[model samples]
Target: VKTTVSVIKADIGSFPGHSRTHPKILEVAARRLKEVEGSILIDSYVTHCGDDLELIMTHTKGEDNEEIHKLAWDIFMECAGLAKEMKLYGAGQDLLGDAFSGNVKGMGPGVAEMEFEERGSDPILIFMADKTEPGAWNYFLYKIFADPFSTSGLVIDPSLHDGFTFEVHDVIEKRKILFNTPEESYSLLAYIGAPSRYVIKYVWKRDGTIGASTSTQRLNLMAGRYVGKDDPVMVIRAQSGFPAVGEVIDPFRTPILVAGWMRGSHHGPFMPVGVADANCTAFDGPPRVICLGFQVCNGKLIGPADMFDDPAFNRVRDQCCDLSSVLRAHGPFEPHRLSLEEMEYTTLPGVEKQFKDRWEDLPE
Candidate 1:
């Protein structure tokens, strides 16, 4: 069976400010999404990470299907109206456009879609992040697809030994390039290492089978200003020819630092949290990531086994909290706060202009 999985997410609004989505608004989104099921989707799940609501659906419509995209767009708009009436925080905040332009790509929401022939037991995983940019997934993608330390399969499994290919996007330039791994892994890193500018858009197995994908929309670029952080969603297919489920989730156990915290302006550990615990608080984050694992049979979505809802991840979350305090102590310093260039949504540019004349000329 050919299955197309589309995950679209946006910060329609949050209850009491960037913390969580209200139950009422989720009801609005859930109800609308349910309406399109028999006609537009095979199976659908509505969930959220931090303030962004996610519509995860399985369909045969393929990637970038206008009807599917429009369904997501319509759901968000209706939810936004409910949010507005409820006086929710940042209501309709991520809907940057006055109207949907036949698709939601530039309109505001972050989307990641993939279509593939389902294996006998198609186990898929989604990593949804809150309070971070899309580039935040770069490191995780690299570790799972390229690094032998995290992905033991890379060294042991013959299928993975040939290595995978990376599709990277320069979010600022809105351009992309592909690099085959095992040979070009380091070359791939030289760019994604920055994370803020370059992002891994997709990954493919040696046989050209798609392995993973991340939403590449930099909301700042589309909105021409900072509206909300490009809190991203990612899809990864596991087992068989690809990395095992363990290899994919191993990288997050270390709690790597990523750009996105309070106001999308700081660096913080991307904490792996259970879906129920995914809300932006703490200094507006220690950015949270929730992984939902599913087994697809025919066209049905069988499980969203909250991947991090295990005791195994408790230490990771605790370590992330400890690290967040250390970074937060820096309080506006580099390596903690994002650099000027990375602060694409910040007021730093105008602040730079205001302070420009006060500086004395430096020695040549």
Candidate 2:
């Protein structure tokens, strides 16, 4: 029997502000899953990314199972109804499509799951981020996948010697192009360095061993409007073949900044936070990411280690605190404001709205 773990996420609702999910909405989702658990799933866990709610399930159904996908879809719909009832901010925000058309891939919501011949004591990381888009993972992925500074395994581990291949997507074009790393790596970095656009959807070892994967399809790109920011989710198989858990987490400690805070617009340091920690102080964030380590065998989840809960990492959190205050103090200055390209979805919309009549041709 082959084991598989699926990490599916979608924004159900938020409290008045886009702070966190309403508890009752999560309860509805959990109850809906519980009713069908013994019949459709082996075991499961439910969590959130700021306003988005995620359902991580273990099953034999493999990727995009209709029953499994529908189970998640229905739960989100129920939760969306609760959001509407409560008149929460960004209610039913991630449920973009008119209906769940087979899979949730382009419909709305972010989904990343992989089925593998289970490795004994298989440890994996489940990462969920909010108040930002999928492009936010670009820097973290580059460090873990390509850079020697972050992943020493590129030299230490023979299996990693061949390096990894990257499939960079022109998310706007809905087109994908491939490049092999340690070779064409500089070219890959030139594009992916801009986190608001390109994102790493999946990564594999030189020998075809799965290394990392994330849902790449951004709903805003597909929806053609500010439907909501892409609250992304990722699942990584760690240790041994891939980078160790530290390599996977070290990049976050730098508090590397990205675009997104209030209205999914603004810049702030990326904070390495723990489970159930989703509150933006004043500027809307310190955009946050959480790691929940898990073990699976024969399609069942056995262990989940909260990766950020360590005394050694406390200083890094403090550093992020300082960076957040520094950036917040700037209060919408150049660089502190998002890059021009990213601004297209934010303030530019209002700026463009003002110029709508100016473009009217008189004598061209």
Candidate 3:
């Protein structure tokens, strides 16, 4: 039997200034999802990453199922109302549309979906990040799937030696292209390297099996303005032909600088934190990523093992904190501050436009 895993998430509301989700909001969502538990959805799990509420569900309805999408849309709308009742900060923040049309894409919220035949032992990982844009996963995806250095499976595992194909999306232009790994990796890197523009939409093994996939819609781009960070969600299938569970997670051991810090204007290290600690407190960030692992058996999600809960990741968290401090010291400088192109959605562009004519052009 085929099962479709749909992970649709959004920051419908946040408390204490986008730091975390309110309990009442989550409770409302849980109740709504439970209402459709057995009939509409085969199984479901509701969780949060920072302030964004994640509704992970499994169904036989296939990808972009209208019924499933509307179910999630309705739940978020109800939760947004509850948040407003409680005066939650950034209430109804990620719901970019007043009404749900056909689907949730282009209406805000991050969505990663996949449909496949259930294997005997299916180990899947769900990665949800806060305070960062969708493109933040570009680097990690490349390293995990393409780089033999990060994923030893590329060198050792015969199944993965065949390499993978990556689907890259130009989020700004709404264009997409595919590149085969080991052969066209440099071509893929040339685009994804400029993560602010290009993002990895999904990946597949050479034989067409899904390797990994990410939610690629940027809320800012869709809104044509800054609503909030596009905080992304991803789903990766591990073991068998793909990388092992450990190989899939090893890229996060060293903090990598990603766009997003205070006010969504700075570059800071992306820290892998436990799901329980997935709060965006300091500078609204030092962008954080939380991972949950599950074993799917007969369309049921089991053991949402907090992947980063291990003590081994503690040192990396400390290192990220240290890096955050150093980067914060730079303040308004480049390499710390995102480039002017990336700052288009921020207030900097408008502020710079005001002084555009007042400033004199230098003559060399």
lDDT of 3 by residue, 250-347 (tens): 98998889987777888999999998899999889879999999998878889799999889898899999999889988979988998888888887
TM-scores, one per candidate: 0.96, 0.92, 0.97
Looking at model 3, report the run of 10 residues with the lowest lDDT sum: 219-228
Q: Give one digit per residue, the lDDT tens place, for model 1 in 1-364.
A: 5799999999999987998988887777878878877778888888989899999998998998889888988889889998999899999899988676678888889999889999868799999999998998998999998999889999998878999989999987889999998899789989999888899999998787889989988887787776758899999999988899988998889888988788888889999999889988888887999999999887788988999998999899889989988998898798898887777577567677888889998899
lDDT of each: 0.88, 0.77, 0.89
TM-score of 3: 0.97
Q: List the residue pairs that clash in candidate 2.
A: 3-299
Pick the winner on TM-score between candidates 1 and 2.
1
Local error of candidate 1 at residue 279 (angstroms): 0.8
Which one is best on TM-score?
A: 3
Any idea what lDDT model 1 has? Answer: 0.88
Model 2, runs deviating above 4 Å: 355-364
lDDT of 2 by residue, 35-109 (tens): 776679887888776777888888888877888888888888888888988899878887887677778778787
Cα miss at 90, model 1 (Å)? 0.8
True-structure Cα RMSD, model 2: 2.5
Report the number of clashing residue pairs per model.
Answer: 0, 1, 0
